[model samples]
Target: MTDPELTELRELAAQGDRDAVDQLVELAGERGDFDELRSLAAAGSSDAVDVLVELAGERGDVAELRRLADAGNQDAAELLAELTDED
Candidate 1:
């Protein structure tokens, strides 16, 4: 994608445009737009997951974290452990 397209995508996401989010994800997945996908995940966009799996850096609620961990999110599991330990 060109810089202009990326700028437009970023603006759309910033505005909470769901169609833009879905379109971006589809474009990234189909066109190897990995960097944009990674950016969205890093920004805490829930659109990253097909069904709510935890992204590497997301600090989600404990129960959800545990669920994701059980579904194979190592980082989520680690965060859950750490969060639980502090309780």
Candidate 2:
């Protein structure tokens, strides 16, 4: 993604465009851009939250998962539990 494209997507997303949000989420997930995904999740995108949870779990990022769980993300909580259970 180029800078201008990212900026454009951000602008569209900021304007309540669901398609833009979904596109951003998809791009962020593909790039493993956690910060972008987090921002989208914070903005109330459940798809972003789902992608964040999956990425964190795949990477075995306990801290990230914990943070998301503390933020009331049930999928993160469940993934955290599953990961810890393997210990």
Write one digit per residue (lDDT tens) for candidate 2, span 11-37.
999999999999999999999999999
Stretches off by above 4 angstroms in model 1 are 1-6, 50-87
Residue 5 in model 2: lDDT: 92
**Alpha-carbon RMSD, candidate 1:** 8.7
Look at candidate 2 and tell me the lDDT of residue 65.
98
Candidate 2: list runs displaced more than 4 Å.
none
In the predicted model 2, the residue pairs found to clash are none
Candidate with best TM-score: 2
Per-residue CA lDDT of candidate 1, range 1-87, in tens?
Answer: 787997798799778887777777776656545466656655665565432433332444677667657767676678888878888
* Model 1 TM: 0.46
Candidate 2 shows a clash count of 0
CA lDDT of each prediction against the hidden true structure: 0.64, 0.96
